[model samples]
Target: MDRGEQQLIDLVNAWAKYSEATPDADVAGFCLHYLTETAQPAVLNQHSPVASPDGLYDEKWVESLTGTANRSLTEIRPSSRLAALVGRLSKYGYFYSKKAMFPLNFKSIEEPVYLIVLAQMGTPKKSELIYEMMVEFASGIDVVNRLVGMGYIEEFPDENDRRSKRLRITEAGLTILQECFPVMNRVADVAYSSLTEGEKALLIQILDKLDRYHAEHYKLSKNAGFDEVYDRMVT
Candidate 1:
């Protein structure tokens, strides 16, 4: 068989696998699925957007790049590209979240998050809140103080540790959180609107995996030097 026949065979195989994996079968997303899975270096130009609501990939565009398959990720430097994209996306996340939060009286996304965590903990010691947040002691205390002053949360002396205080989300905090949930969901929707459900699920899986990986090393490497941290993490 010719190379053209072999490419067709591979494409069909990808379809079969995807059809099996997403039993409901994301037919529209298959275009991107093929491109990404095959890594076919087709120029996703101004005309050919990388992500589309419809998950469209052009067949003629694929045919135009017939000879590019032999190329590899080294030319693209996928890791660096991923890192840069993640950093830029974080800026977008902060921008949208900040706008959505203004009317709700949240200074940042961390406020609602702190309330949620404290609520779940059912009156945890202040140190425990800091540990759960993985923030510096001073930074965590600042957040706690702001919440206390806003009447969003309250802190009382910890009976178990006289020197430490305990914290709980106040009724006002819970009320604000209830209001914030739908608004925050809208913010998330704006961010993820371009992705198909299959793509969203895949993104969640990838991000969750990364979160788990970092959570394991977070405490152990907290105070370590850059070289020590990199060596420990990279290996």
Candidate 2:
């Protein structure tokens, strides 16, 4: 067949795959559904059973494929759609943020501790940053060691918790921040440059709400619908 016919067949095959049906087994069903919903009146009025132009296929062959696509979509659409959209949002954020960091020449995951140390400015113990950065205790220790070795930060025994250590960005770290922070700020500006100030505030507010909800409830909510999960979390 020509391009149009081949493309139509390919499109139906794709929908079958998306819906998690075997294309060779279920294609006729997908095609039948597509034609029923979208075909012209003349096509629908045809006397003979519908088939590929090669006459190797027929509408009856697709009879059981009916609603397979809808059933698949119904089962997965809610979670899948949210995952796809939110995943892209996170992916692009990381993409731009990485591009922002390229000039810093410190691409290791541990490098962010320098910025965190500067931002927190000795208000928090180095141990506490493990939770703040959502990393393991050992990981936080490793990063802190790396920063200390780099002379970008200095750690001191916490007065209240003698076993714990608080961190402060050294003058050297501040010097590096002078070079790096502007690049981060510029990248952030480009990333959110589409939003108005009000929209930015609103987005932050909404994200805070989502972050809190998910942080508290995501483990409990897995494989469960939102209302059921929320109810479980509340009770």
Candidate 3:
């Protein structure tokens, strides 16, 4: 057997031992963590460890590894349960946001824009707000204009720069928020209704970590080469 095949066998054996030793350890997650933490440079450079030239050479080795991995853990692969939960939550959010805004004459697009304007009240420039919200400039401009036309948001010329405008929520907007926020919050409460307070806190902590990592580490520049740019960015 080749060195890579031997390594795979050894790794699988080690995982089997560990899983047997700790019945409650998330075995699938343990496997994924091990693979990620101990990933070799060759695998990093090549992208796929299992499909690499040095990896499992034939169906027999693959079957052997599979059997070994499953001996201690019914599921040996990573799962999408978290992602599926998020997807379901997204649908709930969409439905609730639409329903919550119906009374205020706010649609899906306007609801988010209104919330952003309400939060920013007096400080950030409109352009900065749009960029922070990660929306297209033209689309954001339209929403801002609509909000202004509705008298929910007021704009003032930036004192620092006469050419730019700063946005703030008006009394009308504040009143609307006071009336609607509790209802909107109820929608969120419904989404997490099944989770205990402890579970909610834990989920928030985990999701926050993911959010920070994704925002800081997963950004890609359109101009840079794929491998070099991404490797340097994440590293």
lDDT for each candidate structure: 0.76, 0.63, 0.64
Model 1 TM-score, 2 decimals: 0.71
Which residue pairs in candidate 2 have backbone atoms (N, alpha carbon, C) closer than 3 angstroms, thus clashing? none
Q: Model 1 over residues 1-235: C-alpha lDDT tens digits?
A: 9999998998789889888877677766776566656554454333443433242234323322443322332233355546646776877877989998889878777788899899899999888898899888999999999899999999899887799888988898899889988988988888888899988987886788899999999888878998999999886
- lDDT: which is higher, 1 or 2? 1
Cα-based RMSD of the predictions, in order? 9.2, 16.0, 11.2
lDDT of 3 by residue, 1-235 (tens): 9999998898888788667867676756566556556664445445332333343334424443434321211122223334544666777687877887777787753554555555764667888767666667898778878777878788898999999888888788777777776777777776677899867876776688788866764345434687876687555
Q: Deviation in angstroms for 31 in model 2?
A: 40
Please give the clash total of every predicted structure, in order.
Answer: 0, 0, 0
The runs of at least 3 residues in candidate 2 whose Cα sits more than 4 Å from the true structure, single-residue gaps closed, are 1-80, 108-114, 121-123, 160-162, 194-202, 212-235
> Which number leads on lDDT?
1
> Which regions of candidate 1 are displaced past 4 Å?
10-76
lDDT of 3 at 95: 81
RMSD of 3: 11.2
Candidate 3 segments whose C-alpha is farther than 4 A from its true place: 1-88, 109-113, 116-118, 215-229, 232-235
